[model samples]
Target: MTTVTSRPASAASMAWAGRASGVWLRLSVTAALLAAAGNIYALSDLEGIYGRETSAFVNQAIAQDAVDLAVVSPAIAVLAFLARRGSLRAYLTWLGAVAFMTYNYVIYTLSVHVGPLFLVWVAVLGLSAFSLIGGLAALDGQAVAARFDRAPRRPAGWLLVIVAALFTMLWLKDIVPATLAGRLPQSVSELALPSSPVHVLDLSFFLPAAFISGALLLRGRPWAYTTAPGLLAFLALTGLPIMVTPFVAQTRGDEPAWAVLPPIVGIVIACLAVLAGLMRPLPRATGTPVKVPVSRTDRRHPPHQDAAA
Candidate 1:
């Protein structure tokens, strides 16, 4: 039987795996602070969007802001911590967090009217966009993949594909009919917004990434190992707030519980389940030996050959 041994990763690879760039770190810290401050201010002092005249979209935005303050703000801090350790997983997580922030701030910047926090939202949008590009560029896909074991890859891959497909169907279902009828989606009128930022961003970026990453993972491609976990984590973390938004609005009497509760609850359950699965430890590969050929002279006197020569 041929012996198979794992090749040890190079120092350079390990260094790259652990080292997050100073630029990314600084951007992440600044973004987190700004996000926290903006969300807090929105939750407490911002009333224009929360009053009786506010539309459904405005209420949803407020609720999402609450979630941002309570959940996503802290998540950015955690991403910073992970990145500081130079962890590949942490780096991926940071990327995901950036994606989530990018998506969130896009909605804020475009959909919401200009307000006290307008510039802050714009700053977040710009920072997140740059940070994401920087983070993705910095990562070594093969190095990141080497950090994880084989177990979770399949499940994570499938989950990502399923998520991508479902969201694609969900968005297109609304979009296609509206296009065919030459009418705006009801969400547009209800939210009183120019268009659906979620649809635009998801179709343009998020869903596509999900689908691509999922397909790669399913095929046992290296890129999947690098991208899928982060994508899944991003979706899960950001999605929690989305799932909670309707319930929050319902409690505030902005909308009926039945309208937003049931579907979101199911979504929440699915997201939580996948998040849990993804969080399971992916043990590093062990004892995967690669055969190195030994010449006859070396094999005959392995220990003394070099010294004798």
Candidate 2:
């Protein structure tokens, strides 16, 4: 008969697990920041479209955007706060609650402007956020690495790199035509949109930052853990204008080029879904000796003892 033995969780393994929590908290904030930054552009022109003359109607319309900000910003901030060593699920749950609140507000906020059709967007965002929160909560760092200690597997860090690459490509596609043409390019004019090269550059920064930040998480490096929030801040700032602003609606007539945002937004959602999926804990089997039943006499007198007798 064979006996199974259990291994104690090691410090290094525990450290890795702790860092996963930090990575997830930072990622949640990154997503929230993206939503916040996207709103910056959407909200910037709110007064213009709704018109200062129609202040009452316009302010009422945009109130929900402010509420969205209120719901998400604090959630991101709280996650960041609780992202210390050894607080994984609690931080993720807090962050998830924050995400849930934001999505709830998103439903209300989108409802005010577009209609029931856009409900899918809100649902997708809510579901994705919950998935990330869940993945972080369920991660078992020791078990994860232990199961794969000998086997080769794709690195979790690759997901962030892929997202960064995709965003980089989109940013280039969005900006190159304008930069080469000079004068904010034809797209801005066609879309009649307000844009700054500075903002475009700022958006481009998130790619390298996210890739680097996620790389740190993957490598289990010290600075990578420390700098995650800063990286997330970069992500949030770059992405905020996409979510909150009424930029899409405002671009209808003059700025056809600005219409690129909706597709980009869709891509961001898809990328996050993929990222969350990749982070999920995979079921792993460990090779251990299977235990078999033994008689009391056999247990009392092991093979060596029986031989000696």
Candidate 3:
């Protein structure tokens, strides 16, 4: 009985791997550029670009500044991963990606609601974009077998969907009326909430994120990598806006209720993205097995080829 051995890697497999590596490299470069841009913008004294609260996070410890640290830390970690190998790099890259994404979401929300603050947006976008870039950069020469099995297998995914949808429906009930009421020029001081559709759609985007994050953690992705940024990002983008509206109105001596989702789900999605990255499958060894090498004399001397030997 002959045992079949695996064959060497094929041209197609090599080509695919090359392409994947290239993509990761490009992503890393993008992340680095964005991070640099963010740093520059943060330094600029542009009005409506930096909020007092947001500025604190960004400018904290200029040498050890949190925003700079958070954004750059991941890139460094990603670089380390690329220079090295094994699960450690994978873990670091994954965590960095999560942090970057979460930061991105928060900055995105603030920029949209508070003001342009394009600098903050650029910074956050850079963090996320760079994280992805860094992540891909580190993946250069690495082979990953992409898998479609990241989606949760249990009923929990579905259950959360239903619950989130309901919350969205409830949240919407409060929002639409408020939005309509607030639309009036005289409505500045009136308490109003978001529309139902907004709540539902927001929830729809949010819950999946939470579910993804949770799943990633359970599947053993790092906390920082799987959960932090996504949760923070979602909260900043979706949760904070609603909370801020009332404060904004109150600061102006008015009262208004802006709709906000609980954000339980958004947290999950961020976590999942990290986990999914870590758990990404390695390339399956495919192709027919080739026989192991044997001595030419042995092959020629075989019962079937005695004359040839």
Best by lDDT: 1
Name the 10 consecutive residues with the lowest summed lDDT in model 3.
140-149
Error of 2 at 169 (Å): 3.3
lDDT of 3 at 8: 28
TM-scores, all candidates, are 0.82, 0.39, 0.38
lDDT of 3 by residue, 1-309 (tens): 112222222321221222233334344445445555554554453333444333222222122222443444355446434422223233333434444444444534442335444555555555555545444343212122111122232233333335445655666566567668865222212212122223343566555555564454344332223232324333333332333344444444544343332343354454355434434443434555333333343344321211100
- Candidate 3 lDDT: 0.38
Clashes of each: 7, 25, 35
Better of 1 and 2 by lDDT: 1
lDDT of 1 at 243: 66
Q: Rank candidates by TM-score, best first.
A: 1, 2, 3
Model 1: pairs clashing at backbone N, Cα or C within 3 Å: 4-289, 5-288, 5-289, 5-290, 6-288, 6-289, 18-86
- Give per-residue CA lDDT, model 2, range 32-110, as digits (tens): 6655554554467664434432332343235434644665555565745553333332333343344444443443333
The candidate that wins on TM-score is: 1
lDDT of 1 by residue, 1-309 (tens): 112222333321243333434566669668878988888887776575344335566557676887777777677778666555444445566777777888888888887777788899999888878887876766655544554434456677777788789889988998889979998877665776667888888899889999999888777665676677678767776666666676766776766445545565665566557655654554335444333333343344332111100
> Global lDDT of each model?
0.66, 0.43, 0.38
Cα RMSD of all models vs. native, in order, equals 9.2, 15.1, 13.8
Candidate 2 has a TM-score of 0.39
